[model samples]
Target: MPDKFDTSLPPFDCLSDSQQQRLRDALDVAYFRAGETIIEADEACQQLYIIIKGSVEERAADGQEIFAHYTADDLFDVRAQLDARSRHHYQALEDTLCYLLPREHFIALYQSNSQFAAYFDGNLAQRQQLLDEAHQQQNLAEFILTKISDDNIQPCLIVPHDTNLTAVTQAMRDKRVDAALVKLNATPQYGIVTRTNLLHAVLLDSLPASTPVSQVATTPVISVNKGDFLFNAMLAMTRHKVKRVQVLDGDNVAGMLDLTQVLSLFSTHSHVLTLRIARAKTIDELALAAGSQHRLVETLFNNGIHTLFVMELIATVNEQIIEKAFQLVVPPEMHDRCCLIVMGSEGRGEQILKTDQDNALILQDGIDWPGCAQVMARLTQTLHQLGYPLCPGKVMVNNPQWVKPQSEWLHTLSDFVQAGTENAVMALAILADSHAVAGNRALLSPLQTHLHQLLADQELLLATFTRPALQFSVPLTLFGKLKTGKEGLDIKRGGIFPIVHGIRALALEHAIADNNTFARIDQLTRCRVLEPETASNLSEALKLFIKLRLRQQLGQQQDPQSRGMQQHLDISVLSRAERDLLRHSLHVVKKFKEWLGYHYQIRD
Candidate 1:
């Protein structure tokens, strides 16, 4: 048992072998039966207690409430021991054994080891600093992998869908819940009603107090599956603009996930920054909000937020910027007449920062709106003001070629597939990734369906679409190292694009509707187009490419005079672990291209 606790290990590892032996020799194994008080409130703490088995609870003076718990391998009452007093009632939770280090021996260790001393004396910030350095020292950060389920303290409060607003509000208030899950017993249809929903319904919409909650609630509840990464839950909430998400346990409601819980867990600045963007009422205000974007990214990245979460958060913020811009220029009536869609990285929800604009307008057929061109111009100019460069190909809505009636878009898609011209095919590739950011999304869905139907049987076209994935050299030398240019390897041209474009092309062939690369890989795997291992490797490779690109881009940004470095990845600047990962990822990229070629019967 002592061997398992390993007194000579971290928070104690700095102690010399002799010191460890001295402590080990002084260690007295003590036992306490359940409910026995280990230390009373305000009593002097004469020993340092380390749990070897069972658990102990830190309780209030009356022992009615547990403030915290300590289990196996946990050290307790260090602050109290240092101050020579017990701060709370510490009682055994079960029959337990703990190693007791006498005050004299503990003082000797404290006087001897600075590393050991810093840990016990440190506050939250100092402890977090120690966690920040964990990656470099083979120590793991427990915070990074914290599961969402750990914070799900509120069992989901369920109410019948037919419950009136007055009753629902009273029920939520009585239960001390800010949200309620409205379940329909007849059809299994469940929806979410939050405090915000109630506000919008009663205050904004002026709905009657007797209105059923299900009528006011958000239908088709967006939820994060149980066991999903907590970051995924946060990301899902940000994208959907919801305050809470249902924690689903296989189609059953397991619990409720409040945004506050996630925010507390991360304590990140990005969420607040994103809210600023969402609240901006004018172009100047939005530009001010957008200016802090670089700082937000830098801060979150340094704090060890995963690249996937960071990218999604950034993309979501950009979407808010674009949506706000759309709202500024377009009237309420015109919103239903056209679908403003973004393609490329923004559409795929992978963009980390503002880049070139690749947007188009899908106008409803037979709509008489003379201000369409004017609105598109204002929208494009406003986005440019927000730091998005205009698309070089004039894909912006202001360009008449990119803005057309829904019928025209459907016909154009058909023509593009049949002609298979180079320019037409490039346009098709862009449209393949299009996602509606504002306006009537219904106008865009049918057009996407028409596109899929036109090329559903076109095998030759699929091969042609995938051929551009081989346009660039692999950027790896015959010696299996990254091939570098004067700047660095072309990260986007050689790695990111091929994987994205290749997967997108394959998706088109299979009629997979997902635009996100990771989602496409999962769908492809489920459909047996790729093996599970291959899919996982591809996903990992894509993430690595994205992380490298963002780092390289940010690095280039640090030098004010640098130019033409967007896709350039300086191999020399990468850490050993990063470089090794890059080498292996590029190998995976090469294999991927070869696999695509073999599968499509396209010779190299």
Candidate 2:
């Protein structure tokens, strides 16, 4: 219906003639001279412009420009059609004739023509996201100063260099900050303090409080200039995991940037809970902190942070929260008698999202527990409240079957290795990945020690573990094509799990205790357990798999009906790029499976 010269839009052959006629009738042609303003930045964009002739330049006020040259039916201002607040100014570069479809007309055409609407909906959604990011950047620019300036900040908690440990401790208590700056010459230099330093100096070393603060003060203080953005300061704190930062105005000490302040500025309520759990004294506070786990995972994933980092950071936080919870709930007398162990993905530090509780406990011999069962029940219940669902198979710490003494767990592993049944192998797979989340780390160490001993029998290890690694065949046939079925292969079973399981098998064979998937891959590569090419392929496959899952999880958040269906993420929502990555990843997985089959010499 509308054309100028060479450029042609994507074919609308699927649409009925009536739908095409509707779109044609709605389009309004307009002309602009060179240097004419098509749209202004920050203004509401009420119409979509498709250039029928000539070219235009889109520029931000800050001098960043993008050229959008079109001829004969090329979409120009699709972003304006989607986002009400267009962040860039559009100007004609030459004599331009364009068709303007007003919002009402566009929507009418969209409703009447399903195919036409689908084209706009998908592209418009992406363009709107870009606009929202631009808007966020603008907002961030406005808050830059307020975020940096230590206005409304508390004074730097200080103790004299000569002050006794007792005085320094009192100052820390009084200030409520974990650390105090030891001001030596009134000008800040070469003095620092923290709870960790206090614990090491006073408790572990049995030093007296009257001991000079200089003895405990960490020198070469990590300080940030006042002119720096709060984000930089937050990064510094996050990197160091320090509770306080010295705020400086050039050379002069201005104030202190406490973790609380930074957390308050950049974090949500759930993030605040993480800090609270770190400092929590009672079980109640720890439980409350644990409750925020689901929200924390959702927020972190949604914010576009690196998924691997998010998983590791979340796992770290989870371990801290779990430790604190145990400290709060478990009686002090039993602390030495028991150990809390995390199993499965939790232990591997690859918990991309919250799922069920997979934990176990190892109690010391000669420990009586009339209250132990009740305690575990309460613990699991608390975990359930904190967004972890109870293990459907009753694999949690609450189960008496899973909770046992160190000798018992070792014997169980020995039995599993000897029997080498499917169930026993599965149990071994889960136990092989176990890491101590709380309580006695020694209890879990024995399991690793025994596994290393068992792995010495290479034939048995391969027979038991390597079989599961080839359970799911990778879907190479789906490559470069849209997966039409509602049920694509479970990505976890088809791709992620096999790689993870295969890597675990290799790690066990090598006696590698590294639970991280990436770490395991690296370790295997270094030890010549796996070829460099295979390791690289596995790494890329894992990355692409996690990225796809995360993208799906994020998309689910936008759909109200699918809020809780994150585990059953829709693969159809994946972009063409994502689908390609997935296909390539699966091909790599298939290659890895073939390698495993040959190396393990499995007849199946």
Backbone atom clashes (below 3 Å) for every candidate: 0, 2
The local distance difference test score of each candidate is 0.80, 0.70
lDDT for model 2 = 0.70
lDDT of 1 by residue, 195-257 (tens): 889989999999999999988878777788888777777778777777688888777788878
Pick by TM-score: which candidate is best? Answer: 1
lDDT of 1 at 556: 73
lDDT accuracy of residue 340 in candidate 1: 93
lDDT of 2 by residue, 316-352 (tens): 7777777777777788888888999888888898876
* Model 1 score (lDDT): 0.80
lDDT (0-100) at residue 451 of candidate 2? 84
Off by over 4 Å in 1: 1-144, 161-173, 191-221
